[model samples]
Target: MTVTELLDRAHALGSDPRNTNFAGGNASAKGVERDPVTGGDVELMWVKGSGGDLGTLTAEGLAVLRLDRLRAMADTYPGVEREDEMVAAFDFCLHGKGGAAPSIDTAMHGLVDAVHVDHLHPDSGIAIATAQDGPELTARIFGDRVLWVSWRRPGFQLGLDIAALKEANPQAIGCVLGGHGITAWGETSQECQANSLEIIRTAARYIEEHGRPEPFGPVIHEPLDEVARRERAAALFPLVRGLCSTDVRQVGHYTDSPEVLDFLSRAEHPRLAALGTSCPDHFLRTKVAPLVVDLPPEASLEEVTERLRVLHAAYREEYAAYYARHAVESSPAMRGADPAIVLVPGVGMFSFGKDKQTARVAGEFYVNAINVMRGAEAVSVYAPIPESEKFRIEYWELEEAKLRRLPRPKPLAGRVALVTGGGSGIGAATARRLAAEGACVVVADRDLGSAEKVAAELGARAHRPSDVAVAAAVDVTSEEQVVAAVRQAVLAFGGLDLVVNNAGLSLSRALLETTVDDWNLQHDVMARGSFLVSREAARVLLAQDLGGDIVYISSKNAVFAGPNNVAYGAAKADQAHQVRLLAAELGAHGIRVNGVNPDGVVRGSGIFASGWGANRAAVYGVEEEKLGEFYAQRTLLKREVLPEHIAAAVFALTGGDLSLTTGLHIPVDAGVAAAFLR
Candidate 1:
């Protein structure tokens, strides 16, 4: 088409409601298409793909590609990658259809060969056309420069029309159909873009001046008490469905705000006919403008019917006209014949949809739009895309296609864990296992050097020393400390999804021999320390809204209080109780708390001191070897439990994919505690 013809068509199309399909039409190119003016092969074209708002077309939405290769690749790769891949393969996919996968509209673009194509649904265009002034307005805008075609269903027929137009006017920039978006092309990509923008801007301006919106008077609704409102919200599904005559199963009711009340209460509810969404795609969620009403509490079913009749009639009339103007003879009947609408009582509006999910999504969007409109009112005008324009983009096939793309990931593509006693033994073992399972670990211990060494061995997946017993050391213990540590962990490794509270201490003493100082020291390091660390861990888990596992290193002493271990046994028993308490308190917050009680853990564990070896030997009236053998023989497993065994228990508790068992105290004592009668 000639440049002037294209420009005229763009202008006409910009004002046509049917021209814009759901989700808006997108026009893109790859390789070089000859420019009408410059006759140069520099490749460029504007694509309507990125902008989320169908009503407004911005430069950012336009995806530019090499023209020659884009068309050819599309013909070649029918079912290849979608958007990004198509763009990436553009350079190599030249010539005939090779191994490339092209966009669905590749054939259409190749057929039109237009430098610039614009698509949108203009609501005012549809609203005005219910009568005859619509065509008259078209004539006034284009004069002789534009070629107008009768409305046709998009796809083959539309493509044919463009082909004919191109044949008729070799220098034509673009074309416009009665009920569709406009198309404009020029020798340069910029010119085509500018032409499209100018046409739409001009049409918007005309609508603002000629099609003035009616004023709505302030509506007054009965004030509702907070208790009543909350009760109403609790039964929101039934209430909202009753209001809008649609499902509300998935819909959530927000507390009624002043804006919602005011919007719902307007006396002269402005007709949405002129501001319908641009296309049918939007109808998937937003059926149509919500029906605004003010019904009395005593209103009868008949009264409600009468109000609905008025609103439905208006909507049906507008919809019929739109269909008649745009639908092809072969097109199927529109489903859900009635457009969705909102119903407002004395205050607040409810959105309607075919299903609950749709209704809820539409309601949320409506609320957001209301907020935006209210904010805009404070600054300037609260202008939204015409309803028809919104409809067109909502229904656009290309726009819908774009939404199917998945998101990408980051470099640290793994889980993260925090180990409380990661400085050595069971804590260190657990940290190492977590790292092996593709997790970055934060090793915290009272011994800073030990923590650093463990962290170094684990490479980049470890944390420094953190004392679980000290209030200030294990930040998870103190609110401030926990907040800081959690924040640091999140900042460093992105997030903390696991915590192993294995930091603890034990002292062996007879009941009478256990002094107050000894009891306090053991309690502080074991029971209090676990409490502090677990508290911090709970805080982090709650803050992140993550359900995490916490494994406390308790002991078999928790169940069997042995002689010469009064202080240690008591502390361990208290630790088990703490776990249960934490589990109960944090269950609602998705935090799982549990404990591991193990006995006879040899192999360099602090539980077995050099002095204990000799002391136990003396008690048994046997040598060290004999005492060790006797201790081992007492267990059902008939084996000495090692530090690694305890580590394994720690691993089982914190690991994901395990059963969600909280407040549990699993014995890792080889059944020895059961053998010893209390």
Candidate 2:
């Protein structure tokens, strides 16, 4: 089969989460290609390369190696002790320029005698693979056709072992790699795929047939209803995330999926979860084991939080000990003492990583682990690879090398942001800019549809395009709505780090013409709105104990004394001073509060466009359309400020460059000398 068909096959297998976790599987095909050097045909193998997900495999992600050279190198094999060197040797076996770095699994697919090969970590197959009696169980389930290969760390030696087993068991279509996953081979890509599916299906059926009821024991703690479970998760995430981030900042993901809730509520959860995940892929992402905190479903938030604080510290100490116990001089420095996965019996799972996609995927992998443990316990006692071996894999030099290959993090990589009024104007611009710098963004606005559109666009540009941004609806004036919006941000990406209070409304009226309703509406939307948003977010920020940011999109009228703008100007002045007041009160907590005063954010501003533009233009004796130019010409710099300009100023206020500069106001009015802070 052609290499194109191989990629199609790889995508099919990876697309099914049942077959593998994210980036977990590898596939290959042996084929003939024309050699430019000899002007003749040569044998080559195309396999999925390092750091590539099978679901999204592309031509560029395939490593092409010459079979003759790869086979020849086997003769000089330095055995298992120097198997790491064999990974480097694959570089030499590369054909021509080589498409991508060959993964360690390259040997497993390459050395096999079959023309087509697949090495997958399907949940059902891994359930049997990691079972206590995996070898005997394999014989019972698939009989002799599925050979059982004992556990061996993945390397060139393991590849050779599989190849030797295949040669001896001539009739076997595939093998179950003990304490790991599954592998299958065939003469064609379709046949290989079929054999892989058959093994997975048969193993799954066998487990179902022979499994006992209540494999995890009866549920001792039933999950809370959906809303209450989410509320508990939301309440606990920031504190837990903060604990995880003591050494390094982390992005978090929360999931209350049925499988997760089911697993957490079972009686055997603590025992099985503590035993840890079996597959290296799952273990690598989830760490050695999860941190489980069990409390009654009706427990008070205060009690639950207090319990978490105690447990979190113990978890860190234990994790540090785990690192100390197994580390060698050559092992990579301990990555962190933080647990990747945290389980609350009534809630669901909270997973942490360096970014949103990583965090989300990490949690998803643990769900796969849960499934693995359940399946294994159904028929056989759950048995993972030993702790020492897990330590070796966790700190492997090769994995460290892969990590080093990643680009350095962006300035706001792990920070979370909530941009109010993000559907349009400065808020939207700020959301885009922050997301571009790697912050997880919550685009919140009164217009749900508009917010959703912005979030969709933001996610498309993100590294993994999954959880980088989300939309939330908020009127800001309503305390309930504001709190919910902030909670949405916390539930989405752990907790808050940046908040832009930009939602506002205005009406330009002379003192005599303005009604109290006009005054109250403007004040309620801008002044009271900013206060509620700030107050609710502050709860999470204080809980995190990590420094955070609060930016107010105040107006130049706060200091400019603009005409026929009494209500609007008064509200702006209130917002501007709130920045100073909050900064002073919160400085000890490291919560920096700042304001941006823009005179002419007229072009794209929602406040300006909704009739406020025409009234203000009338007051100044200029046409509404030319108001931006009029305002610009009035400025000392004679420049027109756009939404992007305001966004940049917002970024400057909290974007590390001005970390120590709080209780400050930066104008984005293209140099409005009259609106100087002093």
Candidate 3:
């Protein structure tokens, strides 16, 4: 098949999570390419590169290597002890710069002799791979079609062993790398994909037919109902997230799928989880093991939290011991003692990472582990690779080098932020800035569609990893909505680190024109709403003990008594006080509350377009279009204020530079002397 066709095939196979997980597999096709210098057809192979996920892989994600050169290296092989050196050797053999760096599995693809190859970590396939009697199971399931090879950590030598077996058994289409995963090869891309599927399906069918029932043992505790489950997660998430962030701040992901809940409820789960995941990909993301709470479903929240604190401390101590036991002097310094995966019997799992996507993927890897355990135990004991072997992979200098290759994180990296009124005006601008600065963002607004658009734009444009931007529909004036929106942040991103209270509206009216309803409505949305949002956010801020930011979007109207703005001005005045009030109360927790007072934001403003601009324009006897210029003329600088300017002020208050500064207001009003704080 052509190289283009091979990529299509790769996309088809990788699209299904059942076939393989995020970045858990590799695929390659051997073809003839015209050499740049000689202008002669040369045999070359294109394989998925290091750290590229097959599902989203592009031509650029493939490594191109000349077959002759790659094959020549085996003759000078330094053997298994120096097998890692072979990875460096592959660069000299590249057909070009190659699209991306060759992955560790490059040798396996190049040396296997087949025209096409697929190395996958399918859950069902790994179930057979990790089974205690994996060889016998492989023989029983696919007979001669699939061969079984004993586990060897992946590198140049494992490729040689697989190639040697393929040479000896010409009838074998593939081999299962015991305690690893599966591999298959064919003369063409289509044949290779089919053979891979054949093995996965046949093994899955074998387990389905012969596997024992209730393989994980009967449920030891029933799962909590959905409502209670979420409540518990909400209550405990900040606490758990805070513990994890002591070393490095992290975002979080919560999963309560039926299978996960069922697995957690089973009696055998803790024992199997403690043994840890078998796949290197799984173990690396989930860590050596998870922290499984010993408490049952019936425990009170207070009781459970108290016990969890002890368990967390114990987990760290045990993790430190594990590191010390396995690490040599040259090993990469301990990454962290925090457990990526956390399991509560009644609840499900909470996975954490430096960003939202990492936490989510880590949880997915653990789920794959659970599936592998289920399939393995159905037939025999679930046996993972030795801890020493896992340690080798975890602390390998190659892996450390990969980490060092990553681009440096932006200033707000690892922080989670929620922006109210993010649909338009200052809120949207602030959301974009924070995301660009590397924060995982949540755009909340009364207009769900508007929030989603801003969220989508920010999510796409921001490339720094570990982020997952989302949108939530919230009317900040409603306490229920406010609480729910804050909870959504905690659940989506582990915890909240920054809050921008930017949801607002204004109406200009004389005392006679302003009704009681106008006064209360404005007050409800700004004054009371700010209080509600701050109170709810403080719970998480205090729970995390991570210190946070709460930036208020007040107005110059709060300080300058403008004509026909009595209701709107008074409400903003109330919001202004909340910044100082909350700062005084939350300072001990490291949360800095601040405000940005802008004179007038005309362009791209939801409030202005919704008639506040025309109302104020009439009050000043100026055309609506000239109102912005009119305000600018009145200011000392004669320049109009903008959303971005206000947003920058918000960032300056909390973006690390102002860590020691709080209970302060920054004026973003193009020099409005009358509104200056005195």
Candidate 4:
């Protein structure tokens, strides 16, 4: 297959949760390339790069290696494995346009004598692969179609062993790597993929026949139960969240997928859940073992808190002991193991990370690992790589290097934010700024498409693109919608840390000319909308017991009213008043309420897009072309206020500088003396 076609198939395999999780596996294809130096057809292998996901694999993501050079490098490592030296040699074998770090399994792929090779951690297949009697079972299940290789650390030695097995059993289509995963190969990509899928299905059927006593179906639940679960989440989430916090500021995420539910609901859950990962690659995300926090459904809030405290203390001690055991052999002394997966007896799994998407990635892999182990326990036993081997994988310098490649966490890395009217104007700019600083933002607007576009743009640039931003359709005036939006944000990102209330409308008419509709829309969106958003956001922040920021986008007209803009000015005045009252009310809880009063932001703003500036220009007896210059000349700074300027001011208030200040309005209009703080 062409490289593009191979990537497409690889993505199809990796994206399926049943097949692989958290970029756990890689694939490669052998192709002939014309050597630029000698017009000769030289054999090259293109393997998946180290840090890129198969789900988003591109041609550029594949690391190209000259097959012969890689094998020659392998020949030099004849005895005790030096992982570091071996990796350097692999890097040295890069052929053409091949600087990307090849997958750690590249040598094995190059050694396989097939045009196409695929390695996967399919849950069903791994369940059997990690079983204690995996070798015997392999003979019984595939009956010599596959060879069985005993547990070996992945490095130069493992590559050599795999090649030896292939040489001895030339007719075998694939091999089951005991205590690790599955490797399949064929002359074509389709044949290799089909071989892997058939093995996975056959193993799954075998597991079902031998392991489970009863057939399993999806867990049934009523609509009200889900509502109750969310309610419980609001009330008790903080207790567990507090236990998981590495410090006072960082927040963690909770995952409650159907797969998690199934695994946590198993009969021997506590024993099975505490076991190690299905393979070493999984340890990168889930740690060696999970931390179990058994919160019974009937437990009271006080009981829940006490149980979590006790469990957290014990989990920490166990992690310390595990590290101590391995630290002596680890080249660099190991760091303390932080809990990755937390299992709640009655609830589903909750995975912790520095941010939301990191947590999601860890959670997905852990859930898959749990399913695989359960399948193995049913038939025989889930005997994954032993503790010593798992330690090597966890502390390996080459593997740890990947974590260092990520940018340092921003101040708002673990925080969640909500931006009303975020599809356009200052709201959109503010959402982007917050997302850039590492906050998971919700872009909420009446325009779903615009909101989605804004969210998509932010997500595309984020480190964890999938979880950085989400779009929500909200009419801020409706109490139900406002409350629902807050709940959704909490459910999606675990909790709320900041809220920007920016949705508003304008009515360019005097009180006498204004209809009730005009007055109501302006007041409802500006005055009432800000109130609703602030109230709901406060509710979540208070429940979280974490200090947060609530900012309102008001108008300078509140202090300096325009001749025809009565409704808008009066409503903004009321909105500013709401900020003060909210600040006074929520200050004790450390929830800061503030406002940014901006005027004449004509560029890239909804107010200008909707022609509000043209109407105002007519009243001022100036052309629309001169309106920007007029506002610029009017400000003491002699510069027109841009949406980004307003957005920067909003971020300033939410940031550390004004952490002690609240209930104040900062103007963004070129100094309007009349609108200045008295």
Cα lDDT for residue 400, candidate 3:
92
Clashing pairs in 2: none
Model 1 TM-score, 2 decimals? 0.40
Cα lDDT listed for each candidate: 0.52, 0.90, 0.90, 0.79
What TM-score does prediction 3 earn? 0.97
Q: Give me the runs in candidate 1 sitting further than 4 Å from their true place.
A: 1-25, 33-108, 120-134, 141-154, 165-182, 215-281, 284-678
State the lDDT of candidate 2 residue by residue for 1-678, as single tens digits. Answer: 478889999989999998887889899999999999999999999999998898989889999999998888789998789889888888988997849899989999999999999999988999999999998899999989999998888989999999999999989999999888999999988999999899989988988899987889998878899888888888899999999898899999999999998988888999998898878898889898998886777788999899888888998899889899998788888888888999988888999999988899999999988888889999999999999989888898988888898999999999999999999988899999999888999999999999999899999855465588999999988999999999899999999999999998889899999999999999999999999999999999999989899999998989989788899999999999999999999999999999999877888888888999999889889999999999889888898989999889888887799889899988878777778878
Q: What is the TM-score of each candidate against the true structure?
A: 0.40, 0.98, 0.97, 0.88
Model 2 error, position 406 (Å) = 0.7
> Higher-lDDT candidate among 1 and 4?
4
Model 3 stretches astray by more than 4 angstroms: 461-467
Residue 186, candidate 2: C-alpha displacement in angstroms: 1.6
**Clash count, predicted structure 1:** 62
Off by over 4 Å in 4: 38-41, 214-224, 247-254, 329-337, 447-449, 460-466, 508-524, 558-567, 574-593, 607-615, 623-629, 654-664
Clashes of 3: 2
